[model samples]
Target: MTKGRAALLVVAAIVFLTVGFVIGQMVQAAGAIPGTAGDPLVAQSYVEKIVGETVASLQTKLDEMQAKVDDLQEEVDALSGDTGTNKGSGKTTLPQSSNPPAQGKTVVVSGDSANIRTGPGTTYAKVTTLVKGDTATMVSEENGWYKITLQDGKEGWVANWLVEVK
Candidate 1:
């Protein structure tokens, strides 16, 4: 990746971690609510709401940062005359492939119930549920999440803690 892309990725990872930390603190706070010692769902819901809001806030920031990155990429593309070189990364970008299944690697769910989500973060909507022995193809990875292709060929992302590479 280019230095610019790498920097954006670092920022994204930091956002993810910060959100996780905030949710953790919120959960701790919720657990202390009076008369709710026996019911953890309240805490769960609170954490979920916090996560959702944090994700929404970060999404806007990401969009703005992405626009900047896109502008830089466009400038680079123009100067390089649309060549395959990925400037600042010292690497050549590979041409994309048509075959989806054969393109990337695969991984299997290590946990009993793994959530496959619309995006890498837990704040993203859960699109499917995978149990132990479930498998998916690797698509992309950033932060502590894995973007995967389900066995049925649908695309989604999962938390890295839930899976092991196949």
Candidate 2:
């Protein structure tokens, strides 16, 4: 054959092969083969179903958590309401004194010089001194002496004659 004709035939063959390759690629992308199960529609539906279920479950969990938070808020409100007027909790008033002397009851000093002793008697170590009108809590009273707790939480005894029950 002549050189020009042979060149033309080679060019035609190359074009045909390129066209066939392009067609093959298009067919593979279409996923039309039977039993291959790679259809775009089917894959999209599966992904959508899984995502929908996940979102629904998350919503349900959020609702349950909100319910628990609401319940806790109700309990807190109830507790706050009960604390305002409940006199039985010991936080409302001081204990009432029943006898002449009792611990934790407030009393006033009646003397100018009162010695606070370590124990409930005169022989114990003198802890401190209390001036007149110094109010203290009478812890106990024995033999005309009063065991008392000072304002600073110190425990001691004072002459009963120097303290008057208030």
Candidate 3:
């Protein structure tokens, strides 16, 4: 072959290989999956859909947490002596006559029936009656009587002779 023709053929082969390499790379890029190691490009619509779903899930969780906080606040308000009413149960809670003693002890009524009086003496008016096996928390002692708090938080006096300290 002539030197000029051989040189022309070599240049043509180099150009053809370069074009083929470029086309092969374009085809591989077109076939690659988005967001994968082969392709890092992600579509905007796909990102928006994922972000919207995550935001919705977080909003649902936040609503549930707010409801729980509201319920707990109501309970705390009721316990802190607000309105003298239990909001959850719709019941009137009586105020404690006095704070429980640091060394309060449980006592049971040993008599057939014992009077719960407003005062320690027999002259005091009867508020209620406690029968045998009825229990109360003895707050303090007064003149042969025991000042006690009932289960319902009511305070009254009972004769010590009619109760057995537990």
lDDT against the true structure, each candidate: 0.69, 0.67, 0.73
lDDT of 3 at 157: 94
Better of 1 and 3 by lDDT: 3
The TM-scores, one per candidate, come to: 0.39, 0.38, 0.39
Error of 3 at 102 (Å): 8.4
Show where candidate 1 strays beyond 4 Å.
1-103
- Model 2 per-residue lDDT at 98: 51
lDDT of 1: 0.69
- What residue pairs clash in candidate 2, if any at all? 103-139
Put down candidate 3 lDDT per residue, 67-165, tens digits, no spaces.
576567677887787773544443223333354333389989885567788987554667887766899998987656789999999999987777888
Residue ranges of candidate 2 with Cα displaced over 4 Å: 1-99
**By how many angstroms RMSD does model 2 differ from the true structure?**
29.2
lDDT for 22 (candidate 2): 99
lDDT of 3 at 65: 63
Total clashing pairs for each candidate:
0, 1, 0
Write one digit per residue (lDDT tens) for candidate 2, span 60-103.
46546655665565666577786435422321222333556656
